[model samples]
Structures are given as structure tokens and as C-alpha cells.
Target: MKKIIFFHLLNDYSGSPKVLLQVIEAVAKKGFEAELYVGGGAEGGFLSSAPCVQKRYFYKRFENKYLTLLSYSLSQLILFIKLLRYRHASAIFYVNTLLPFGAALAGRVLGIQVIYHIHETSIRPRPLKLFLRWMVERCSSENIFVSHFLAKAESFTNIESRVIYNSIPQNMVSSGANHVYPYASGNKFNVLMICSLKAYKGVNEFVRIADLLSGQQDIEFNLVLGASDSEVDDFFSSVTLPDNLTIISRCKDVIPYYQRASVLLSLSKPEEWVETFGLTILEALSFGVPCIVPPVGGPVELVSEDKEGYLIDSNRVEDIAAKLAFLHKNPEVCFRLSEAARVKSLSFSVDNFESDVIEVFNGV
Candidate 1:
């Protein structure tokens, strides 16, 4: 069996790490010897629970943006040197995201195959983003994108690329499977939005929607963020929270939030940060919970208009509030959408994801 060397810049409670964790688990189950060279060593994120893979830390994450960038460049330099030491035909480099350019460069120089699993398009500093794209174009043997939207947007003329949509891990799916339809909550309509504490992720927009519908006592809003309590407080210090809205932070378990959700929300700003495959939306859908995603981006691909959920602009506070109000008032419509969402989620299954990944590995 060929060995797999996974390189990820940061290991936090984010989408990229979660997807890489799934990929590593799938590859390991197939009896491949795997090792992960990640920065910050999981930080109690999803990768902390990774199975059958040796974990190694190379750098630490910083709170300051400029310091983080400096640390990132340093990590890559260190990764380039480490990858050089492990250069062999039997070992392939699996670089997660566009940030780990050092491992990709090393693989390119050593004539070893490198696969780039790209997840985002919002890389800042136009020149730096262009440089990373150039690296991918020249160094990567193949590329894996999380959505059709991303694949088309970041297409290279010569590189072989594949779109493998992220799925709910089998363990997570099983845990939510036994839950009764519309699990928990008697008469209250629970609206939930789970995302990182980033402004471009539409955190403010979600808050605005909650405020707009504050008068509706039966409807409650929940924002489950992946940041610490202090960080959450600092972010919302200037803003006033609505009485009907509840803010939760650093929640290790989001399944309970999904179980109690009447409708999940994906309010990512398309212009600033297009959501390349909404994993949380899929998780909520698996639990028979419908969603209200943004009008554009990869999330639109997951949901059908007026079926599982509606596609509305997150910036339109009145429109979003109206949709939530309608769902809260109409039980039959909400139940119908929930059933559709559950059925739609079945298409993106772990079996399908693993099979596609195995094919990619074999081809390499």
C-alpha cells in the first residue's frame, strides 16, 4: 500500500479540517499508512478525533491577522524541508487547501504526486492569491474541489480536477437517524445558524434577521459559532442582541442544535465569501430540518427553490424574517420541506464520497 502524507496549514474547528478529517478516515480504512503534518495540532477541533493516522504539529496559529500570515509562511518553509526528507515514489502528498504551497512545491521538485484539495476562493491579497493559483497550476498532479461552483470558478486549463461534494460522516448520520421527525421542541420554532465567527460569513445578517422577528414570541433564533466565549463577546460587544436570539460558542456537539432546529440558515455573503458546499446545511437536512440558504454559491446547488428551502438574499432582513415567520406559522409546509430535505441529503452519502476518493487514489 502506498503511504499518504497529508499537509494542512491550520487545524481548527473549520470546514477544511472537517473535510480533511473525513478524507483521512476514508483512506485509512482502506489500509493505507497515513500521517498528518498540520499546524496547531487540532486545537480540540474535529481532527483531534482523527482515527488511524499519526498526527504531527509544525506551527502555531495566532490571533493577529498579520502575525498569522507570518506564521503561515514560516510553516510552509518548514513543511517544504520536511517534505523533502520524505520524498519517495511510494508516498504521495495530499495537500489540503491552497495555503500549503510548501508541500506542493516539495512534491513537485521530488517528482512525487501531489493532490490539492481546494475548498475556498476568498484568499486575500490579489497577488498572493494569484501566486497560489500559479503553484497549483504548475505543481499539483490533480485537484479536488468541494463543489461544481468551485471547480468551474477555479478551473485550470491543463490540470485534472474532480468535484467531490462533502457529506455527513456515517457516525453523525447514524446518531441523527433515530431522532423523531422535527426532534425536540413542543411549540417553539427554532431557527439555527452554525458558522465560524467571521464577518463575511453573514454573522451580522443572521443577527439582523433575529432582531427583525423579535416580536414573534413563538419563534426563537440560535447562533452556534465555532469561536470562544470571549471572542464571541468581543465580536458582538458593539451590537445589541435581540431578546429572542441565543448565542452559543465553542459547542463541541452541534447535533443537538440540529435536532432542535426548525430551519437551518446559510447566510454567507456571495460577493465576499461564497460558501463552497454547505456542510452544516447537509447535517441539518439529514435530521429532517429544512434550510434557508443564500441565493448564490455552492449552497444553492444543495437546495432547490421552494422545496427543501428557499434561496434568499441574506442582506434582505425583511425577506428572511418573512420566510421564517411563514415557516413558523405553517406546520404543514415546514413538515413537507423537512421530508424533502431529508430525502435530498441521501444523495450525498459517505459511501459515495469514499468510493470516489478511492478511485482518485487508485488513479494516482
Candidate 2:
């Protein structure tokens, strides 16, 4: 078996980096030898302190535009040379961003088989797309997508792409319903929305949903937010919530919050910017937390009407509020969605993810 390497070099603490890391960790635990190629030195970046991942050369906290580009090229060149020197003919490369034209050419020169892992709805044009297509279409390797929608978008590429959803472990999923008092009151159902307050994430509708569910005797909205940018963080810092809402920014383990919530609210607008595979929705569903998602995007692949979660017709606040009101008024529906959600989520366990990814790498 050829040794495998996973490649990514970004200072952003984003979901795709975490997904790549999860794949690396899963492969490592299975006793497979794999190297996680990530730059380090940035204090708050995704690659910093990633467990079971070996830090390569010059990962030291980079910013400044030119330096960032320089850092990217240098890191890949180093990784490419390292892979060639390792006596491995095949390598699995995971990329969240497009590379400079030079780096792509260097990888081909190194004779390393690269697997491009794309986890976003956004695409870069011009020389970037041309370079990426050349790398994938001409390289004769695998392309991994987090959702079918993403795979289909890249269908024009002659490269073979596969959709494998991100998975969470079954044991890590919360099994018991525990501790829900501090956030909610007397039979009020808990509605959870875990996302950064970005335009793409539709943060205002999250606020709107809370506003609609406001003053309800049987419902409270709990927000789990990560700071995407300083402006957004500042916006969240200044906001005041209604009496029916409780906003929590601290959650290292979201499964507990997932278990406590009666429903997960996804209010992201336009299928493209909002979601890729609905990873948060999967997390919620895994713990028997029913979800309410705006009818759009990759979430369509996961959410069905009254099944895993409710697919409300609109992103409008009234419709979302109306749905929440229904969930609150009829607790039976919540329980039913909860049960169904759990069953659906179990199919996406991390074990399944590991097996699928390994099989793809192994040509199984």
C-alpha cells in the first residue's frame, strides 16, 4: 500500500479544515499511515494543535497578503518534496482553496497522486479554475465532495468525484437527555441554531426566529455561534435578545447542546452560500434533536418533510415562527421528528465515513 498524505494550508478556522482533520484522525486510528499536510504557527488557525497530525515546514502565523501567498506556495513545495522523498507513489490531498499555478505544476512534477477534497459552494474563476481543472482532469485522481450538489456542480470536469458526507461517531453523540433547565422554562421546547453570524449563514433570520418565538410560554431559542469576522463578532456582541432567547457562545462539545435542543433551526438563504452538506443538521439529528431547515441547498439532501427534520417552505420569518409555534403547540410532533432524526443520523456515523474514505483511497 502506498503511503497517503492529506494536504491543506490555511489560517482560517473553518469547517472544511475540521472535516479534513477528522478524515486524517479516522485514517490514523485505523492504523493507516497518513500525513496531514497543514501549515502551523498561526495561533487561532485550524492547523494549530491538530491532534494526530504532523506539522510540516514553516507554518508560523502568517497574515499580510503577499506573505500569505508566499506561505501557501512554500508549504506546498515543501510538502511535495517531502512526499516524493517518502517513497510513496500515491497521496491523498485535501484542499479548501485553489493554489498558485506554480504549486500545482510542482506537484505533477513530483509524481504524487493527489485527491482534491472540495467542501464549499463557492468557486474561483480565471487562472485558479483553469489550474484546478488541469490538476484534476489531467491528473487522473479522485475528487471528494461533501455533498452531491457540490459533486454535480463539478460534473463538467472529466474527473470522477464522489459525495461522502461528514460523519460523527455514535458514542460521541449524546445518548441521554440531560440538563435543559438553564436555557428553557416550563415545557418550552428548545430551538438550537449553531452557526456563525455571517451573511451566508442568514444570522438575521436566526434572530427573527427567536423574535417570533419570543414570549412563547413553551419555547426558547439557544444560539451557538462562532465568530467568523470581527465585524460580525462585534455585531453579535452589541445585540440584545428577547426574553424567550438564550444565546450561548461557548461550546467545545456541541453534542450536549444538540441533545438538549428540541429542534435545530437552519435559516440560511439561497442554496449556494448557506450549506454544503448540512453538517450541523447531521449533528443535531444524530442526537435525536429534530431540525427545522429553510427549504434550500444541500440540506434538501438531508431534510425531508416531517422525517429527519421539517423542511419549511420559506426563509421568511413568519413561516419559520409559524413552524416553531406548531412544534411547540404539538409536542408529539417534536418527539416524532426527534425519533426519526436520530434514526437518520445513525447512518452517517464516523465509522461509516472512515470506511468510505479508506475504500475510495484503496480503490475498493
Q: Name the runs in model 1 displaced over 4 angstroms.
A: 55-57
* Residues 96-180 of candidate 1: C-alpha lDDT, one tens digit per residue: 9998999899999998888999998888877889999999998998999999999998998888999999988887799767766
lDDT of candidate 2? Answer: 0.65
- Residue 121: error of model 1 in Å? 1.3
List candidate 2 stretches off by more than 4 Å. 11-14, 40-51, 56-92, 96-105, 124-135, 138-140, 174-186, 228-233, 237-240
Residue 74 displacement (Å), model 1: 1.2
The C-alpha lDDT values of all candidates are: 0.87, 0.65
Q: Point to the candidate with the largest TM-score.
A: 1
Clash counts for all predictions: 0, 4
What does candidate 2's lDDT look like per residue over 1-364, in tens digits? 5556556655444566667767776667667666655555544544454555565555443436567656756765675565556444554444443442223344566665556677755543345566666666665456788888877766545667778888764455545223222223345578888875565676777887787767776777787776544545566676776787766653455766765677788877764364667778887776677777867667888888878777774367788788778777777777777777777876777777988887876682
Clashes (candidate 1): 0
lDDT for position 360 in model 2? 77
What is the Cα root-mean-square deviation between model 2 and the actual structure? 4.2
